[model samples]
Target: VFELGDSVNQIDTKNESKNKSAIELLKVPKTVKNLKDIKKRKALANLEINSLAKLKALYLSLAENC
Candidate 1:
């Protein structure tokens, strides 16, 4: 009976470890996707800023000519 109990405990421990590893594996892709989304947003924001700066310059040049 004692040996049987020990064998069950070992199996439970292994199963727990496998479950934890699977959870971690699932989280990795979500983290990577979130990072990619953040990078894409940052790039869009930079483009908007650059475009506004160019428009401001053009407006100033046109006003000077007027």
Candidate 2:
């Protein structure tokens, strides 16, 4: 069911022991040198996913940031 980009960043494809599921993966950039930030990242992603408008807001927010 996944199209090109949909499958591009799926966490189900990651090793569970090494990566958070996509729902929580947004904050953990792969190159993070400070493990101390993981909790903060997860918390931020959880907050973003808590509501549809928040998710949409993040999507739009990231578009310009990118």
Candidate 3:
């Protein structure tokens, strides 16, 4: 009964997750942009989205640095 609840159901059956063979694109950064776009009419003082794009960009920069 997988009704989309917890981590156990999300784990793959063949145990390939441990090897990190599959990669799923992240959702948070895009979500932040979408939130900003939806409330664009508001004043900049009201902006409060935590942009993960910088974090991801940093990660990519470090990846190439190493």
**What does the lDDT come to for candidate 3?**
0.34
Give one digit per residue, the lDDT tens place, for model 2 in 1-66: 222342213423322323344345555565646455666666654554354344445555676798
lDDT of 1 at 30: 51
- C-alpha displacement of 26 in model 1, angstroms? 24
Expressed as tens digits, the lDDT of each residue in 1-66 for candidate 3 is: 112332332323222332222122222344766667534423221221112233334545766898
Candidate 3 regions exceeding 4 Å error are 1-50
**Model 2 / residue 47 / CA error / Å:** 0.3
Collision pairs in model 3: none
lDDT of 2: 0.46
lDDT of each: 0.51, 0.46, 0.34
For each candidate in turn, the TM-score is 0.52, 0.29, 0.26
Clashes of each: 0, 0, 0
Candidate number with greatest lDDT = 1
Candidate 3: deviation at residue 4, Å? 25
User: Per TM-score, what order, best first?
Assistant: 1, 2, 3
